[model samples]
Target: MIVHKKPEPTKVPGFWEIPSISFPIHIAKNFAKHVNILPDVEYWSPFLNSKTCNYLRDIFLESMILAPVSINGLMDQSYGIGSKRATGWSLQLSDMLSEFIIPHLNEKFCSAKTSTDWWQENPKKNQAWLPVQVSPLFRFMKYESGGEHYAHYDAGFMYEDGIHRTLKSFVIYLTTNQSGATRFIRNHLEDIDVWDRDHSDWNRRALKEEVLYSFLPQEGSILIFDHRICHDVDVYLGEENLPRIIIRGDIIYQAKSL
Candidate 1:
C-alpha cells in the first residue's frame, strides 16, 4: 500500500521554522535540516539540548563568580539598550559552533553558495576568497529586576584587517522568566529596504515602529534573527532575587583576503 506524508506549510519568503527536538537525545540530528532565508527573520528552536544548555549555564555562572565587574562592553546607555547592571562571562570562537552552527548553516540555510557569489561579485584588493563562516562569541547575560533593553540595532563593524557584519544574532535562554522577553519591531517593506543599505540607522528608527514579535525566555530554546532587525528586551518584573540568564552570540560573516 502507498502512503503519503502531510505536506509542510508554505513558508513565508523571509521566515523559516525548525521544530523542537529534545536535547541530548535528538541533538545529533539536524534541527534546521530544512531551512531557508525567510522574508524578515529566521526562528529555530531546540537548537541546544538540555545537557548542553545546563553545562554551558554552569560554566557561565562559575565564570561570573570568579570575574570582576568591568564597565566596558557593547551596550550603550546613551541609546537606552541592554540591562543597566548586566554582568556575565564571554568566550570567543567556542568549539560548539563547529559542532552545531556550521553544519546547520551549510546543510540547512545553503549559505555556502550565497557567500561564494557575494565574494565573487564584490571582490576587494588584497583579499582572499573564503567560505561563509560563523564566528560565535559566547556571552552570558544576567538581568536583575527592572532591567531592560531599549530598542536598538546590532551595528556592523569595520577593522583595520577587515569588516565584520553581524549577519545573524543568536540567543539561547539559560533561565526561565516570565518577564524580560526580547521584543522585535516590525518594519514596512520600505523600511527593510532602507536597513539593507550600508550604515543605515535602523535600530534608531525601531524606537518609533510597531512591534513585530516578542520572544519569551525558554530554557534550551534558541532564537535566531537577522542582526539588522530592531529589537530590545523588556523590563524584568519578577523578584529582585530572580535574575534572567541568557547566552548571546553573533553569527559574523565578512570577506577577508590576505
Candidate 2:
C-alpha cells in the first residue's frame, strides 16, 4: 500500500526585498504633539512617505493571489460574520526586518521609562520583560465597499515563554479612503449584554453613542493601542474602485528571569 504525505508549506519572502526608505525622524519625534483624540491610543501620521506607501501597496496587490490568505489564521472557506469582515493576507517578516523597525517604534513611541513603568504595574510583574519586538507574522487586510467588522477585542500572541505575550496592537494604513473608520467603544465587551447572548443579533452601527473614538483611514499613518480594546470597523463606503488597505500586527515582549 502506498501512502501520500502532506506537502510542506512554502517559505515566505524576506524583508530585504521590501524597499527601504529613510525613517521620518522629525515627524515621529512630534507624535506626542498631536491632539489627544482618543484615550490610551497613539496616532502618528506619514510614518512612511508617500513613495514608500505606494511601493508597499503595489507589492501587496501584485502578490496577493500568490501569498497565503486566511481568516484568523484558518484556511476555512466559510467564516462567521463575527470573526472579521475584511480579507487578510498573512505575511512573514524576517528577523532582520523586525530588528530594523522595532527600534524606531520603541525609541519614538515607547520610551525606557514607559516600558519599565508598564512592566512594574502589570499584573504579571513576577517575570522580567525583554525589549519588545515587532511580530514576525502580520496581516495585510483589504475591505470591500460593503465590508464591516463586528465589535471585537484582539488577543495577544504568546511568542516566547508563557509569560511573554503581545501587549499592544497596531494598524498601519496603506491606503486612504473616504470611509471605513476604525471605531473604538467606551464599553468593554463583557459590559455589553447582547454581545454575549448572540453575535448575529449585535448591531454594529447601534454603538455610536458608546463610541470613544473613530480613526479615519489615512495613507502612511499608524495607530497603536492596547490589545484589549474593543473596536470595530465602520462599513466601507468607498467607491468600488478603491478598497481599504492596512497592515495589522502586535508588539510582543519576551520574559526572562532577573
Candidate 3:
C-alpha cells in the first residue's frame, strides 16, 4: 500500500495515556530493498521540517509535533518491505532517535546534558520513591499463528500524581493480512488510570518481572498503546509464503520534568 495524503486521526482507546496511537499501515514490495541499506541505525536526518519525520511524530503531539524512537534492524536482505523490521511500515523515528532522543531532551527538559549534569528531575524522599526513568523500548519479533503473543501488561506507576511515568508505546506495521491484527485484553484506559501506580497484573505470567507484552506484528502496521494495559498482537498466518516484519521505536521523555 502506498501512502500519499496525510492520514486522518482516529480516536483509539487509552493507548494515548502513555498516550497510545494507531494508524492504517501501508506496505508494498521493494520498500525494503532501498531502506534496508541504511547504515548507522542512529543516523541523524537534519531536515527537521521534512514531512517524513513530521508525519511520524504527528501521530502524537498533533499540532507542530515531533517524536523520538529507538528502532531495530531490518530482516534478511531477501525479505521484502512487510517482511523486515527497519524497512517495515514505520515512521522514520531516527530523526528523533539520533538528533532529539537524548540531546534535545536534555536541553528541552532536564539539565542533564552530560553525565555530570545528572540533575534530578524530581527528588524522592526515599529510594522507594526514586522515580523510575521509564523509556520507550521497542522490539521486532517474527512468528506465525501459534507463534503469536498472549495477553500481557507493563509495570505501572505506584503513585498517583506522586511518582507518575508514562510508558508510551508505538508499533509500525508493514504488511497487511486479515489474520494480523492487534487485540486488547481489557479496556484501554485501565493502563492510564494506573499510570502512576505500581501495577503488574497486566503482564504475562512467564515474564512477569520483565513487564514485557506480546505483539502480533505485520510488515508495516503501527500500533501504539498505553504502557500499562493488558493487550496482545495476533499472529499473521497468511499462507502465501510471506514473512512478517516490523520496525519498532520507543518515544520516551522524562515524566513532566519540563
On TM-score, who's better, 2 or 3? 2
| Candidate 1 regions with alpha-carbon error over 4 angstroms | 1-40, 65-93, 106-133, 157-165, 187-189, 192-209, 239-241, 254-258
Q: For model 2, which pairs clash?
A: none
Sorting all predicted structures by lDDT, with the top scorer first, yields 2, 1, 3
Task: Answer with 1 or 3, whichever has the higher TM-score.
Answer: 1
| lDDT (CA) per prediction | 0.49, 0.55, 0.33
Question: What would the TM-scores of all predictions be?
Answer: 0.60, 0.65, 0.38
Question: lDDT per residue, candidate 1, 195-254, as tens digits?
Answer: 243422344333534766777887666676655565777767865477787866666555
Off by over 4 Å in 2: 1-35, 66-101, 104-131, 188-203, 256-258
Model 3 poorest 10 in a row by lDDT: 64-73
Task: Return the TM-score for candidate 1, rounded to 2 decimals.
Answer: 0.60
Model 2: ten consecutive residues of lowest lDDT: 1-10
